[model samples]
Target: MLYLVLAVAIAGEIAATVSLKLSEGFTKLWPSVVVVAGYAIAFTMLSKALKMGMPIGVAYAIWSAVGVAAVAIIGWRFLGENLNPTMIVGLVLVVAGVVTLELGRMH
Candidate 1:
């Protein structure tokens, strides 16, 4: 259940981030609204996950890792953004770090 809430939080964060880009400096109305709503949902869900007994470190690591990877993919595949090899390597490093953190928590 904690993981589930964290997943929802991650989705919200991702949507909010994408909407932020589409908001065009807040010049667009609908996207701006989505940005606000998404962030609100994201933070609310994240706090709930924490309250549900997920360690702050572990939860945050997973959230940031997934969010970073997902947003990068969305930008590349849907937003015509460039995704270079260097960026891919950086993402791999981020995932690796998160994996290490999660695995260490079992000890």
Candidate 2:
């Protein structure tokens, strides 16, 4: 359940980040609204996950890793952003780190 909440939180954070880019320095009204609302929802859900007994370090590590990876994909696909080989390698490293963290927690 906590992981589920964290997943939602990650989604919210990703959406908020993407919307932030779309907002164009807050020049657009709708994207700006989305940015604010998305962040609010993301934080609220993240708090709920923490309250549900998830270890802070583990939860944060997973959230940030997944959010960053998803954002990178989104940016590459839709935002005209460059996703070079180095960036891909970096994202792979992030996923590997998350896996390592989760495995460590199992012990």
Query: Which lDDT tens digits does candidate 1 get at residues 63-87?
Result: 9899999999999999999999999
User: Model 2, 1-107: lDDT tens per residue?
Assistant: 77889999999999999999999999999999999999999999999999998888899999999999999999999988999999999999999999999999999
Superposing every Cα of model 1 onto the true structure, what RMSD results? 0.8
Candidate 2: regions farther than 4 A off:
none
In order of appearance, the predictions have TM-scores of: 0.96, 0.97
lDDT score, residue 39, model 1? 91
The global C-alpha lDDT for each of the candidates, from Candidate 1 onward, is: 0.95, 0.94
Backbone atom clashes (below 3 Å) for every candidate:
0, 0
Candidate topping TM-score? 2
